[model samples]
Target: MPVRSPLYLLERFDPGVVQLDRELRVIAMNSLARRLLPVEDKQPFEKMVLSFHPERSVAKVKFLLDQAECPVSNPPPMTMIINIPERVLLIKVSKLSDLRGDTTGYTLIFYDITELVSGELPVQPMTPESLSIEKPAPAKRQLHKIPTVSQNRIVLVDVETVTYIRSEGHYTWVSTAQGSSFCNLNISDLAERLDGASFLRIHRSYLANLDFAEQILRDEGRVSLKLRGETTPLPVARTSVSRLLEQLGIGEVDAQRT
Candidate 1:
């Protein structure tokens, strides 16, 4: 087949295809490439398709292509993003060879895979009935009711009731001035429901209410938090010291004292 006919065929092809040379410079591109690429030049034959993907630079592409030339039964496909001003592209790369069996470079075919990953693709619209059909009815959130100090009533207490919360296996122990109570709630769930300003997670296993904290202590270079009515100091990890101080309205001045 003539070169012109092959070029014409490439133009009509659906997927965007760019042919590169040994130096990874674009030698030719199909009509689909013209539509996909942001290049202003009408003639796609001589245009060097520079590495559009920010993460996948020209150096990285060349390195991968070189690796692909090795004798392997099967090579894993490389997924890369093509950064265009108008849209983001998810690209799949395949090594290309010349007619003389020399490793010329690579061919990249890309499509917009952003919507699929981001869950933006509209399936069936969700209705109240449709949402409830697959699962049991969700229990109503009882935020208005305040639980008394007595343990007689079963109460759904807010995170604010507790001065400090500690994790025990699957359950969390919420401690207050009156007493401590166990709840079958994870630290993550409590963190989401808690008031950000009042409560702060100082450790992976513990969350403390800043309002109830009397003082924050640094014991021998290790940090610990002193909660109201609590005899034992709550362990504060070094990683959480900065965030914990910020939440308590204590800045550099307070940090230096501790």
Candidate 2:
């Protein structure tokens, strides 16, 4: 059999096909794709797709976007299976580049996997209830203050004063320039409950405030970060290094990477 035209495949292909612009704005979607996904041209893909699922999916797409290469000659595409309410979609995103190997936009192709494997997967709509197994959380929750039980009393602390959070086994300690406070919540609990952009999970056991971050120091096969007005350094993971360095200033440097 002869190979089909790219134009023909795009128009007549069975799988849901979509073309996204550089800004992740939906430019076009084929008939099958439109029927599967509730999307329209010029609509923001992140905002639209995020509506179906946000909490867990945002980080996934972000990783894909970050791993996305510049040109056709670049690295492999980022692909993942996203389970949304009612359907499971295999989303594959890659760089759409010009002839000169310059990235112009992105092409996202989605395949509905639900039909392939019936009742085994959760087909229920990814509702706020279903999404929040721990607690009934919406797709997005705006957080202004952290509520914690202290001295047998509920204490509401402003979000800005928080410098970092340290988890000691079951308990999570929220630190500030003023001092540290004990919260019944765990570090992972705080990671999900609070504003994610404001707090960076520098390591498994620690979350650092971007506002309070002063510098990242690497020494003797170990990596640590410093916050404003703080003496001791916090642990930094290898995977978290690039993002931290890209965002915050680098202070002291030693020999090796952790």
Q: Which candidate tops TM-score?
A: 2
lDDT by residue for model 2 (14-101), tens = 5666676666666677766555554443244544433433454565565556567633366566665544444445566778877877
Q: Whose lDDT is greatest here?
A: 2
| C-alpha lDDT values of all predictions | 0.57, 0.61
Q: For candidate 2, report its TM-score.
A: 0.43
Per-candidate clashes come to 0, 1
Candidate 1 positional error at 164, Å: 0.8
Candidate 1, position 224, lDDT: 89
Clashes of 1: 0
Clashing pairs in 1: none
TM-score of predicted structure 1: 0.43
